[model samples]
Target: MNPTAAILIIGDEILSGRTRDSNMHFLAQELARVGIDLCEARIVPDRMQAIVRAVRELSAAHDHLFTSGGIGPTHDDITADAVAEALGRPLSVREDARAILQAHYDRSGIPLNEARLRMARIPEGAELIENPVSAAPGFSVGNVHVMAGVPRIFEAMVASLLPRLTGGTPLLSQSLRILRGEGEIAGPLAALAADYPDLSFGSYPFQQDGAYGAHVVIRGADGARVGEAMTRLAALFPEDRAG
Candidate 1:
């Protein structure tokens, strides 16, 4: 079976609308490309209890958990500690991580003070995730992979991490644009979905040039099944444009 994953976004800025989240969608798409199902996503404030609760719940329910935000050197960055607490592990500064940060800061002529050192505090038994964009690294504790919230850094970390994960068959998809309303196609789409229980069918309504239409998309792990479903859908709506 394909690995199941969940995302936990930790930040008060996201919750208060001060910052818009762009990491979840990126992670979801990347995970899907590697055949891991992104089953759930959640955002929580920078509270220890809330982060701990979310981490514990998602960690237990999914094969992998990817988290963004709250791993920085700032005061509100408590993801590492919360994860440690949730897993019943002690949070401490590892010399190896501290050395990496120290060398990076020394080369850049920045001070590696107490606040900067806080970035090296990892949970027991967690593995450090390489950060190419910045020297500060993310870590994977158990199944929870903690990452940065910055879009560029998150993307970079994912590029480094995904190749190491085990993936099943990649999902295949096809879309057909029909010049008909979703209401007109809903019944037939439902029937088609029931016929191919392994594939997923979705109808997305769109408006173009003051005309309403729908895009019927078929997605499945089996390319042949997806193509067959797409063909059946197109035959059902003969006038539609298949793309």
Candidate 2:
């Protein structure tokens, strides 16, 4: 079985509609590519209690937990502190992380003010995840990896982090679009799904130009099995084509 992972998105902007979150979508795809099943995701405001509660629960529930946002320079960036509290670790500025931040700021002629120094407060005994986009650096505490919320920075951190974890076989999928509603094909789809217990069958409905249809997707870790299931599914619905 593939290792399962969860995401905790922390920021008031996401909850307040000031920001549209793309990190979760981006991380989901990246995790899938590495064969880690992204089983759950949660978004919470920039509150200490909320961040701490989610960090503890999600880290315990899945093989891996990734948090985005709340690790920046501002006062509201409390993820590092929350995660440390949740894990019962001391939260403080480490020299390594401070050096990274200081170097980046020095190069750009930016002063290392107290606000900027907040980014260096990492939890105890955590491994740092590289941030190529910015030098603040995300950290991995046990199973949980805390990263930046900005899409580009988050993606860079993911690229740096994925190499550290092992994954199972990537799921393969084939799709077919049928000119029929889900209700019309429910019975056949159910039967097909039953025929391939190891594979996953999904029917997503869509209406285009006033015509209703559904796209059926078959997925499995075994490519040959997924292909066989797709062939049978298409044969079951002879008029179907690729969507």
Candidate 3:
């Protein structure tokens, strides 16, 4: 099986739907490129107990657990502390992380205030994930990885961390969208999926120009199987096939 992974989005803002989640989609695409299958994702509020539960559950379920949000300088940012509780470890300031934070303070001429110092505290024994965009570093404790919540910064951190992970055979996907409704092709796509159990077939309906249609996406770890499934899918809608 491909190296399975999951994303844990830790924030009340996300669950409240005030913030649309882009990190999961970003991490999903990036991990897939590195051959890690993103199996599941969970979003939790900024509560300590909730965050702890999510971390423990998702970490146990997947080979890797990526958590975004709540690792900031504010009081509401408590992902690091909650993660420590989940792992039954102490949350302490690390010398390595302190050095980075201190240097950031020095360079910016900003005082190392208590609010800013909160960023230095990490779960014991966790390795730091560099934040090139910002000085605040992320950390990896066991299978659980914690990073910042801000979008641009979070994306940068994920790009840096993904390369260090070992991945499985990358899944390949191919897609086709026809000007026909999903109902028109559901039976054929289902047959293709059944014939190639290793391949994942999906049909998505869309509305365009006052017409309804479907987009068919086929996925499989094996390129040959994915191609065969696509060919069979296309054969079902001959007139819709483009040159």
**Model 2 lDDT per residue over 1-243, tens place:** 999999999989998999999999999999889899999999999999999999999999999999999888888889999999999999999999999999999999999999999999998999999998889999999999999998899999999999999998787888889988789889989988998999999999999999888989888999999988888888887865645
**TM-score, candidate number 2:** 0.98
Model 1: what TM-score? 0.97
| lDDT (Cα atoms) of all candidates against the true structure | 0.91, 0.92, 0.88
Candidate 3 Cα outliers beyond 4 Å, as residue runs: none
- What TM-score do all the candidates reach, one by one? 0.97, 0.98, 0.96
Per-residue lDDT of 1-243 in model 3, one digit per residue for the tens? 878898999888887888898998989889989899998988889999899888899999889999999998999999999999999889988888888989988998998888988999988889899999878999999999899889898998998888888988888899998778777777777777889887788778888779878888898888988888888788889887432
Clashes of each: 0, 0, 0
- Model 1 / residue 229 / CA error / Å: 1.2
